[model samples]
Target chain A: MAQTNLLSPPSTISPPTALQLSQKAPRIIANPPTSSLPWPLSLLFSAETPEAWVTHENALYACLRTHDDAAARQLLDRLSARFGESNERIITLRGIYEEATAKNNGELEVVFKKYEDILKQDPTNFGVRKRRVAVLKSLGRTSDAITALTMLVESSPTDLEAWAELGEMYAKVGEWARAIWCAEEVLLVMPNSWSAHAHLATLHYLSTQSSPHLAPLNLSLKNFARSIELNDSYLRGYYGLKLVCQKLIPLLSESSSVSKRNQDEDGPPPNLETVKKLEELATSKLAEIVRRYQPGTKEWQGYDGAEVIAARELLNRDANTER
Target chain B: MTLLQTAPKKQTLAQIRQQRSLVRGINLRTNANTLSPSSFQARKAYMVSAYQEGKFLADPEGRGKPRPNPMSDPAAMEGMMGMMKGNMAMMVPQTLIMGWINAFFSGFVIMKLPFPLTPQFKSMLQSGVGTRDLDVRWVSSLSWYFLTLFGLQPVYNFILGSNNAANQVTQQMGQVNPGAGLMGPEQDPDKLFLNEAENLEVLEHRWILDGVEDRLLARTAG
Candidate 1:
């Protein structure tokens, strides 16, 4: 799996049973045809499992997914009865229920308006604001969604989650510099996070690739090295560092061979020797990571499946280049 | 400040939960408010003095020594509890619940139910219909009273906010633990004031716009 995953990456690993059960709509509602036993009876049996409420909650969405209108309605009724119909979560769930039942996107607009009305009544409602954002995104009004998200982050600056979301939105719009800025904000709050450092590095690498003349190359190399220094096992950090070094070694040579490029305080202008040494360091470290956490092992599974796969691909490409 | 508005969003379920926690973090009393240099220093002065005053009231000795605080006395504690229970929350619902409690025990059945149920139920769940010839489906007035008592919470929340009178579950939990809330009546104002004072004293304001001009100039030059 590791060897072949070089050029073509594998999809997300099937979540372990406990996670899958929590994430998926429960089968009880999703597959009424397959289950011979009645839902209440199934509930009675599973009541002791401590996962019943989660199952029931997921079952509500499951029913919607399967288009089991009756089951979905029943689940919603049960939920609303437990937590009053006017409850914010219940209200949003009702909107979601309607959205699911809507035949077309046009019908979903009415549900969207309902959420807007709810927000207009209580503007501070984070729950409603979140629902409104989702509705806007689903409706393909990316700009409107961005507006709402910007407000959310404004009121809640410490929210790393919102920071990440705003970052992704910028990335989607090809606003690479903006995305990098968002990453830096999160990095400011979470200074010691190796992954956050690596993530910022990735953003810099991407921005430079997209617009080399505009992006800050110095931060790109520094951050990736920082990530690796923070957590040597971080495969993505090493992978990104290698790529940045690969690009820099030639650029440094060209600039130096022509004329001494003006160096800034951020770092001595990436010289050929430093770039080559960093590239070698990245390659060896990546190779060690691949050898230690070969795919299909428990230890390997602990590493981000996608990052490991991508690193494998980079190594393979580098090997081919050498050949 | 400038670059933040243009960024990111997957807006997943976990992200929403995270946002809630982060938002909660800002409201903590220990946190210093975002302020300009002058405003921050002024607020710090105000906070320390206010805290000292509160702390002195709770402990007359202030930080010097301990004293027999009246708040800890049984009579004062009882009075505080009475005030909390007698708070505005009791005005409408308390009268209603009291009236119904009397009505149910008075042996006067106001109404019956439309549905059927088993016989051997608690009086709270059964009808208060005053008669021996009662059907099992007849709901006791006491039960109806409870139904309204617990049921109107969501209605209250809809009319108000979620934290308003509608959620008796939270209210009841709050009742179960009196001193759990910030600055509950039994608290030492002195300690609270001192904490706030210290928090304010150490509060350093970093202006977001500090290096804005330089940053923009560098960007333009580059």
Candidate 2:
């Protein structure tokens, strides 16, 4: 009227429809209310929305940070119903399930079964097999443990950890040959693996003692030396080598003496250098054994440990005699 | 025109060698006896008795009972004594010979006897009898079994004191080979304290299957 033109009065503009209002409408209905969720749905729906999903995620995270598993699970469940079991929800739920099982206060088999079902469906999802293998080992199903480890080794042959695990499983079952093979496989992958050499050395020593041959002894000695070379702190391998050398050296010394006595018509004692090398090996290995496994603490207690004590006693006597 | 006394031909080395050959056959027979199972058991029993029990057999029953002295047969005894005295005389030192000669010359004569002073020495030489002393045999057998279990068979084998490992090694020789064997899982000492350690809750109501109690805690706290 003032303009008298009625210029269509700016033609009464209509507000945009709800669907046309925000592209984040789906994000709004799915979020829960928590301290972590700082934004209201109405605010989230407004034109000036400041990251609704992130704000809600932070709120839920804060509740979990406070050790509120119930509140956390509640929010997670509510979100899962809306969002379905996403990877994040699966992981968090699995953590809660494992914690419950570990406490012995909950039904473990049922939860583990559920976890297995999930893993069966996904298969390559995360490190589920490793976790399952660990759980099986804890349950004392050694055969099953071995089978699981076999599968892991087959699937992940290049995985050093998997190789170690397979070796350990074989060792636990008294499959020395297989254990040594697995350990050597690991050594192939990780050339300087002290543990692998230790495993091989132990197998050689135990399995060879009943035989008339020296090949087993030689191989065992080599692996023991290799293990010591890799890690001098591995007292078990060092002492084990010493124990073997203790038995072998006397036999070799006797053989050498016999050879020397027989050599009146010969050029030289048969492989005299071999005897010298064995003696040198024994000396060094015994030294390593003493350095690594000295008996102040009860660390050396059982037969193997007691052998270390015996070695020390013998060495001390030798030193005294030398003085 | 004296009756021709034929010069006794000196026994040549070949004839002496022939005579020595007879003793080798006796040695072979003794060696065969030593290889018998009873001989092995006797040796093992002896070793165990000597080393572990601090006992030695003065007269083991398995050994045959000794005969009474051959010296009781004076003709045979005199012949044996003459042989011994003749051998002793040649090898004996002059000073030792004089002492012996003086002793023999005097009334305190040291006469050589055909039989040994040790009674039934040959009879005591018989190897193990199948059955005799129950307690001694039982203890020996029991100790042998236990020591094998404790891995003493190797030491016994090395000393050539026992034959138990013989059959065992032969039986396993086909399958036995060298390599590291599987080891049993090493139990961590820390595992013993696991039950004693208080459970540290990473999340509560994790025990509650349904979120009902977890929600309740929140509601109660709120």
lDDT of each: 0.60, 0.45
CAPRI band for model 2: incorrect
**Candidate 1 ranges with C-alpha deviation above 4 Å:** A1-74, A213-215, A256-274, A289-295, A303-307, B1-83, B86-222
What lDDT does model 2 reach? 0.45
Candidate 1 accuracy as TM-score: 0.53
Off by over 4 Å in 2: A1-100, A103-106, A209-213, A231-237, A250-323, B1-222
Give candidate 2's fnat, 2 decimals. Answer: 0.00
* Candidate that scores best on lDDT: 1
Fraction of native contacts in model 1? 0.02
Worst 10 residues of 2 chain B by lDDT: B200-209
TM-score of each: 0.53, 0.35
Chain A TM-score for candidate 1 is 0.75
lDDT of 2 by residue, A136-240 (tens): 776677788789777765444445677688778887777767776666555545555666667777876776666633545555655665566556445555566
Cα distance off (Å), candidate 1, residue A99 = 3.2
- Scored against the native two-chain complex, candidate 1 gets a DockQ of 0.04
